[model samples]
Target: MSDIKIYSGSSQVRVMEIKNILENEGIEYQEVNKMDSSYAGIFGEIQLFVSEADAEKAIQLVETIKNK
Candidate 1:
């Protein structure tokens, strides 16, 4: 199994914000988008994932951004 963790979801801007935080903190991550197709038009959720070892650190960086 893969040792990846999901840190956040929704909107591209939100995902990018979290990504920036992680990068500033020297943490590595991967972004995954789950797209949905429907009559209402296409939409998707953005997921930010990091290695298990960096999960805690990534979460912390996101939290810091949240608290600011």
Candidate 2:
């Protein structure tokens, strides 16, 4: 299964929160440091990736957190 972007944000806290949600839900994922594209996050943000199958679920989890 191909990995796809599930979330992207500038806040490490936000990224970790989403990651925890995925972990709690048993949805596998990966953390991509968009910072590598710039000055090590000084000019970019963090990105979360999951398998294509988990992308939708991961997004839903993010939305749930957003609504809170």
Candidate 3:
């Protein structure tokens, strides 16, 4: 049961939106904050991962949200 990365970006708002979407759809996810603590909001990307079994559906959900 490997995890597949479904989204990665520097926008906190967008990241939160994606997390909500995934939650609403009952998709489990793992989030990784890769930002430099010193720079915080100004640097790095937030990554979201889902199980490989759910990767396709998770990606489609993410894309739909992003297109809005």
Candidate 4:
């Protein structure tokens, strides 16, 4: 199954939190860093994805964290 994007953001702390949440839930995901290295914190975002099969649960978990 294809990977489905469930979250995207530029905050490292937030990103790490979500990653930890997913890991703790036993959800496998792929993280793509699109931040411009040369500019570091000046631009871009980090994206998180999971297989299509896991997308719904992943998105729900991420939303709960985001709403907190």
Candidate 5:
């Protein structure tokens, strides 16, 4: 179950939304902390990752959200 990123960004609201959706669907995911350490996430990217097996599914989920 190698980890792969399904989404990356600094949008807290958007990221949380997708995370909630993933959680509801029972998909396991990892959150990679890419935020700047000095400012504590002032200007950096956050990544949402899932297993390779769930990559496609995750992407689809994200796309569905995007379409909404």
Candidate 6:
């Protein structure tokens, strides 16, 4: 079986919010930082990851928040 899928968000706060939503829904996920040294002096993007199966649900949740 394949491991869960992962996504990359743009900011730490966004990643954390997504994580909390996933946790509340009892979904498992992994978060990884895609930052590199070239971005050290500048603002770096953060990533919010979830399993491929959960991708739709995660996106829906975020969309809901955005719509609100």
Every candidate's lDDT: 0.70, 0.85, 0.93, 0.92, 0.90, 0.68
Q: Kindly state the number of residue pairs that clash in model 6.
A: 2
Winning model by TM-score: 4
Model 3, stretches more than 4 Å misplaced? Answer: none
lDDT of 6 by residue, 1-68 (tens): 34454446556666677778889998887766666657642455556667777777877887876576
Report the lDDT of model 5 for residue 43. Answer: 81
Q: Show pairs that collide, candidate 2.
A: 35-41
Q: Residue by residue across 1-68, what tens digits does model 3's lDDT show?
A: 89999999888899999999899989999999998889978889899999999999999998898888
The reply for model 2, stretches above 4 Å from the true place, is: 36-42
Pitting candidate 3 against candidate 4, the one with the higher TM-score is: 4
RMSD of each: 3.1, 2.3, 0.9, 0.8, 1.7, 3.1
List TM-scores for all candidates, in order.
0.70, 0.82, 0.92, 0.93, 0.85, 0.64
lDDT of 1: 0.70
Model 4 alpha-carbon miss at residue 53, Å: 0.7
Which 10 consecutive positions of candidate 5 have the poorest summed lDDT?
Answer: 33-42
- Model 5 residue pairs with clashes: none
Candidate 1 differs from the real structure by a C-alpha RMSD in angstroms, to one decimal, of: 3.1
lDDT digits (tens) for residues 1-68 of candidate 1: 35576554556666788888778778888876674645212466667888888877777777887788
Best of the two (1, 4) by lDDT:
4
The C-alpha local distance difference test score for the whole of candidate 2 amounts to 0.85
Runs in model 5 deviating more than 4 A are: 37-42
lDDT per residue (tens digit) for residues 1-68 in model 4 = 79999988889899899999999999999999999999866699999999999899999999899789
> Model 2, residue 38: what's the lDDT?
46
Which window of ten consecutive residues has the lowest lDDT sum in model 2?
34-43
Model 3 / residue 3 / CA error / Å: 0.2
lDDT of 3 at 66: 81
Q: After superposition, how far is residue 41 of candidate 2 from its true place, in Å?
A: 6.3
